[model samples]
Target: MNKKREIQSSVKDESLIEKRRAQMIRGAVTLFKQKGFHRTTTREIAKAAGFSIGTLYEYIRTKEDVLYLVCDSIYDEVHARLESLDIEKGSLEVLVTALEHYYGLIDDMQDEFVVMYQESKSLPKDALQYVLKKELEMVALFERLLTECRESGELKMTPKEIKLAAHHLFVQGQMWAFRRWALRDFTISEFIQTQTNFLLQGMAGEKISTQGAK
Candidate 1:
């Protein structure tokens, strides 16, 4: 995915700009979750951020800019966290760990994510495209991980299988968040356990039980 777009700012200190925008994103996520994008106003975002309306405007030009920043920050956070995983071994155990890690991260950000999915349609066309591109990059992460497993002989997928499986894994992780209310009966641990087992059984071509997953 492309690097974050340079939002014009009056502030000169790059570090300060990042710091303020981070605050704005945090504040905006809260409001978006509570009141949604259409109902939330820039003044409310400024108040939630513990800053003045004028200061908020110093970093972003519009409320839409704040929304774009929130979506951008979320994808960046997910990418950074996934990059921190040590999954190079490419074993079944490593694969299970990676899935669990990803699903857990998704659960952790369920609200912001749901907001992103629901409100991103309001984003400008170019901003929406950038967000969608970031999503493909996430899918690529899973594909690369699966490729590693295949090379190590822990998986038996063809290239097409690897690509589709990667999309499956990525979307399924988000499914847990997007369908949280319908799945309230299942704990995160149970959800992860069942999904991991289901995925591994298909990918490994054998029933590899993760009995200890719960």
Candidate 2:
């Protein structure tokens, strides 16, 4: 619904664009997650989105546009989930809690995440960069939280370290979905606890555990 998001479509009416795109995105994400972007056709996406093939074409010129839309939607959902956490308190404990919440979301949206990553390469250069920028915004959320901790003197890390640490945490959450074939033996809870423990301890000199803390 955000106009700022870069989505190439022929529809010009903002409200119509939002409504139809919403419908299209809901349907497309399901099909993409289940059948993958390469296997999904525009007709199938239009049917799933409850629109005619003609209507679908009015909005998108290609199936790749649907893939771009799906990737954008996934990023928005993940960022929204992470933003829902209580991050006002920028202590190490609060950061760990946020990480746990984020990891849990990634686990729940495993199929979506997998689809987003696997299909992102199919997007046009501009669309792919848009998605990547959205990813950076999510990373910046953690970077801001880390900055808060530093400003409060509760944690100490260099600027670049903070950036890389935020990036690392995001990657760790993503690993749950992408590496599920090999990580199948571990439950989401186990994965979160183990990862949070390593990240917390590594980020701070203290022995921190978000395992059961949340």
Candidate 3:
């Protein structure tokens, strides 16, 4: 009975520890997003998390470790969302719609997403590389979608062109987050619709009606 009770108590302690760690990560993300990586301190994180500095250190070794934890958490959320998407549907329009949905999701996760986007370089070497690898995987997903669109004759671009196009689209999508100050007046759906229309029009090889196109 004594041994069984000890095991149960350990499990409960571990569970509480994880809960506290999660709280710290959440606080770190908010502070890092607001004040940047170099400016935010462990004391700020601890206070935000309602924990002591010693307690914060129990879960994370350094400020860099907290950055890694915050980045990894955001990456996990993005990866899970992308992985669950059904990419085999409808047409290029459908894919564009899905991309817009992803943009909206990121917008909703602004604090975490912004931290991951702007403070990635603050992570230690290995942690930075790990986060970058996940980012590359996300980019590859867009590349794969473009390749599919090309193979299905939904797009008229060559393989290299398709890759370049995907890169541009990804960059453009990121602008919604990175340039939110400039884009603050636009709704996510409006931005998505306008951007998708521009991309689709370009992909269709339609002639521009601009003054120089005469």
Candidate with the greatest TM-score versus the true structure = 1
Highest lDDT, which number? 1
Q: Please give each candidate's TM-score.
A: 0.89, 0.81, 0.80
In the range 1-214, model 1's lDDT, one tens digit per residue, is 6877668899999999999998998899989989999999999999999999999999999998998998887788787777776656566666677788778878888877888998999999888999999989988888888989999888998999999999998888888878899998999988998888888788898878776642
Q: What RMSD does each model have against the real structure?
A: 2.2, 3.2, 8.2
| Model 3 worst lDDT run, 10 consecutive residues | 1-10
CA lDDT of every candidate: 0.86, 0.81, 0.71
The runs of at least 3 residues in candidate 2 whose Cα sits more than 4 Å from the true structure, single-residue gaps closed, are: 1-3, 6-23, 26-36, 48-51, 85-88, 211-214
Return the lDDT, model 1, position 154: 86
- How much lDDT does candidate 1 score? 0.86
Which 10 consecutive residues of model 1 have the lowest summed lDDT?
Answer: 85-94
What is the alpha-carbon RMSD of candidate 2 to the true structure?
A: 3.2
TM-score, candidate number 3? 0.80
What tens digits encode model 3's per-residue C-alpha lDDT throughout 110-132?
Answer: 77777887888776677777777
Q: How many backbone clashes does candidate 1 have?
A: 0
lDDT-based ranking, best first?
1, 2, 3
